[model samples]
Target: MAIPRVKHFEITLTDEGVAIIAFNRPAHRNALNGEVYKEWDRSLMWAAQSPEVKVTILTGKGKLYMGGHQLASTADIDESKSRKAVKESIVCVQSLLNTLINFPKLLIAAVNGPAIGIGMTTLALCDVVYAVPDAIFLTPFMQFGFCAEGCSSYTFPSRIIPPDNFISDVVAIATKTTNFPPIAIFQTKNLVRARERETLMAVNRNECEVLLER
Candidate 1:
């Protein structure tokens, strides 16, 4: 029997004109390794240049949002290889981020579970995010023995969770074991509004429709 090839993601345009991009690797907690990153970069660039997609909703397949990068996949990689992999991952993620940020359509994360590491950092770039009540948001750069990527170093502290002594807060949270509730982070300074997952989905749908109508 031949081994089957898996698609890293699937894209579908809803009747309401929302482009749904599902990260489809539930078994590995949707770990986005190299192939997934390449596919994501290509797909987002395609979508950004296309006129058909009016909005993009990014979600993970199955229960959890994403477990972040595939740590297990790198078990055999040496330090040099690991560095190269991280660099490539950053390029791919940054490419998609820059494209999405500049794209004409709205970008939203339909976060359903723990959005860890890159999963958490990616939301820093999303225009809207619908996080589940139990959503676990973590940035384990230092913990994971890696520096921050995804332009998160610049964006996360300055904009996403701006607070009193914001730079201090940024330094305080930039570590391995720290996990912060999105709402608690929001309340610290009141720069963002994180709604219930259901409410956010509704708001996403409504906002998409409103944008389409305009």
Candidate 2:
């Protein structure tokens, strides 16, 4: 399939069904804006509907994986939110995160370099996270005087990193997993994350509430 182009990222689908979504705004350190969020939501929806995509690999361009949110995009969101607005925002992001967490196809995050903000937290949602030797992971929530988003508060302390190595450890497991029947894979994935959906949504609401109060 032809790759889709946007202001913030690139999505490439391979014949082998490995869809790679690379953040392309290296000039801004891959900082996410409203457009990126829109593209992300749409891309995930496309992937969910397309049988051609069996797995997705998310990464970034240039030296840094991602930096933080774009100021303009979040400024209005922070300034004018009512209770209903806050709830809506929370529900929207939580829905997307849940879709990613419970994605039908496999999800992999290749942290090419420093990953901060959502970049750091999103690693926890991916089925596999591969970081280069120099890759640095940081939440920067405390540094920014914010709490958490992307469910890192729950995932980070839990040592969400699976296995010791991505290739030998995770790939081997994924190979075995995919070798199984597709229905079996879906069931196993669903069972593994059965309660996590509710937990993550609750966490997202809580975090948003705290942010609103602060």
Candidate 3:
């Protein structure tokens, strides 16, 4: 299956059935913006429906994995349009979180470098995470006076593997996973995630509501 074309993400499906979604905004440190969010939603949904793709791996294009939300986008909002801009931003974020919470495929994250803010919090949504030795994971919500988003409040305790082979190691694991029966893999993931889906959705709603209030 052909991967969908996206401006902010580079999507590729390997022969081994691993779909790699790279955050391609290197100049912006791979920050998430409205366009990126939309692309991600489309890409993941496409991958979930692609029989050729049995696993999905998310990583960054450059040194930094992801810098989180594009604060500059918010900074650029005109004072006169502040309310509308904030509300749109809240909707965009909540929509992305909803997609992640309901994603049915095996999702993996390869932290190439620093993962800040939403980048750090979203790792909880991945089934597996691999990071380089110097990769920094930080959620500075308190500094920004914002509560946790991305269901991190309920799923914060994540396991991380240090760089032995980085992307290659992650790909190896994904390839192995793909070798299993696809239905079994999908069902197992759904069973494991079923218990927390509701909680994650609730957290996402509450977080977005608070952000909107602020």
Candidate 4:
């Protein structure tokens, strides 16, 4: 069946134990806005309480995973609106990440394409991550005059990447550089697998099989 827009989430069963939560927004590259956040929060809560869902695979509909908060949503915000939007945004992201972090079930991120800003940090909380080799990443908050949120401060450094991957340099840049890509700044074995974008569905299916086997 075709999935609808309106910030709705698509949950499909891949196996007995694996569920996929696809962020079904293509027009804006699945960017998270307030409405999307509300829907995502509701969807995650629903999944968390469902007995049939043993794992959740986070992904996007179109080529891009997510480009972070919708730039359009940021438009016309007064100081109060900005604060409220930012605060609510943080809460929405934190709520989803916390659910994944503490959920007994596994959380896997299928990075079909670029995942910018909170999109990148959210993956850090997942149990496993799979990325397309060509995926671009960005954390543009500092460059946009904001501080880090979504618990990335603790999660980022705690994970380790390959020595040859320049983990230290990446971390240093994220810490010092304005609006840097955290994915490039650190490496991690947490990424259990990686693949080309063309094979994303196959890789997702394979990951689901692995999760079911566990």
Candidate 5:
């Protein structure tokens, strides 16, 4: 299947039916912006709908996994545009969170390096996470005067695999997972996530509201 093209993310579908989505903006340490969120939503939807994609892996290019939201994008917001920008950001974030909350495929995260802010929070949404020993996970939301926006409050205490070869190891696991029967994979994930789906939706909505108020 042809994966959707994205400017901010590099997406590839392996023959094993794993869709690898990497944050490609290494020049900025893989920090996310409105554009990145939009592209992510689109890419994830494509993978979810593609029969060829049985699982999806999220990772980052270069050294850092993700630097979180691009604070620099808001640095230039003027008094007149501040409200509008904030509203737009809230919408984009809410949409992205909703996508992750409802995604049916097996989701894996390869934390190659530091995962800050949303980077850290989003790992809770993935089914599996593999991190390098030196990789840092921090959510300085209070320091930044922002609340969590990725259902981290409800999804905390997430697990992670400390692996030596992060990317290759993650891909190997994903490949093995993809070899399972497709219906079994989908139904098992659906049953496991059924109980938390509504709760996650509520958390995502509450988080976005709180973020907007902040």
Candidate 6:
């Protein structure tokens, strides 16, 4: 059967308890944009709530996985709205990261291509990540003149290292993870990451405030 495809992403039902959310913006190299986020939010909710979904494999169409924030034309910032705009934007990213981190099911990221800025951070949120040999991972926050989102401030310090083998390894572990009882998996995730919540919260707030100033 042909797999189901969403306008902004693809959802492929695997053997029981696993799904793949593949980004669909080949032309833009799957850059993160408002519309993509809207769809992503809904898709994520579906995967999280659906009874049969216990694992989500996140990847992108074409070679590149995610190109980070979409490039936008520069606009003269009105003093009145600049802070509001920055805060609102940062809020969206923060909320998404929070959702991903707290999601009950396991998430595996496949970096088929370069993962820049928010893309790199998003990978860190995944329970497992598989990267192609040529994949480049970078956080370009300094160049973008904004603080990092997706809590890379903390995630990178720990998760983004060791550079595991490719998609095959991810598949192996994902398959194993799906076999565990959901309650045990969820509780273990909580127990392991519980201490990081406080740090993550502080960083989220600090990053937003700094973004407004930048």
Per-candidate Cα lDDT values, in order, are 0.59, 0.68, 0.84, 0.58, 0.86, 0.73
Poorest 10 consecutive residues by lDDT, candidate 1: 169-178
What is the Cα-based TM-score of model 6?
Answer: 0.82
lDDT of 4 by residue, 31-121 (tens): 8877787777666666566755555567776678788877643457687666666556555655555554544445566777788977887
> Candidate 2 on 152-209: residue-level lDDT in tens?
7787622233324533333343444444566775777678777786787677667766
Give me the candidate number with maximum lDDT: 5
What is the Å distance of residue 138 in model 6 from its true position? Answer: 1.4
Error of 3 at 139 (Å): 0.7
Candidate 6 lDDT over residue span 168-191, tens digit each: 455566777788899988888788
Candidate 6 or 1, higher lDDT: 6
Cα RMSD of all models vs. native, in order, equals: 16.0, 5.1, 2.0, 15.6, 1.9, 4.2
**Cα-based RMSD of candidate 1:** 16.0
Pick out the ten consecutive residues of candidate 3 with the lowest summed lDDT. Answer: 156-165
Q: Which model, 3 or 5, shows the larger lDDT? A: 5
TM-score of 5: 0.93
Each candidate structure's count of clashing pairs: 1, 0, 0, 2, 0, 0
Query: Which residue runs does candidate 1 get wrong by more than 4 Å?
Result: 1-6, 73-75, 78-84, 156-214
For TM-score, the strongest prediction is 5
Per-residue alpha-carbon lDDT of candidate 5 for residues 83-190, written as tens digits (9 for 90 to 100): 777779889989999999899899998998899999999888888788887789899998988877789988752346565566877898899987788889789889
- lDDT per residue as tens, model 3, 39-87: 8888888987888888999999878899988775555778757677667
| TM-score quality measure for candidate 2 | 0.77
lDDT score, candidate 6: 0.73
Which pairs, if any, clash in model 2? Answer: none
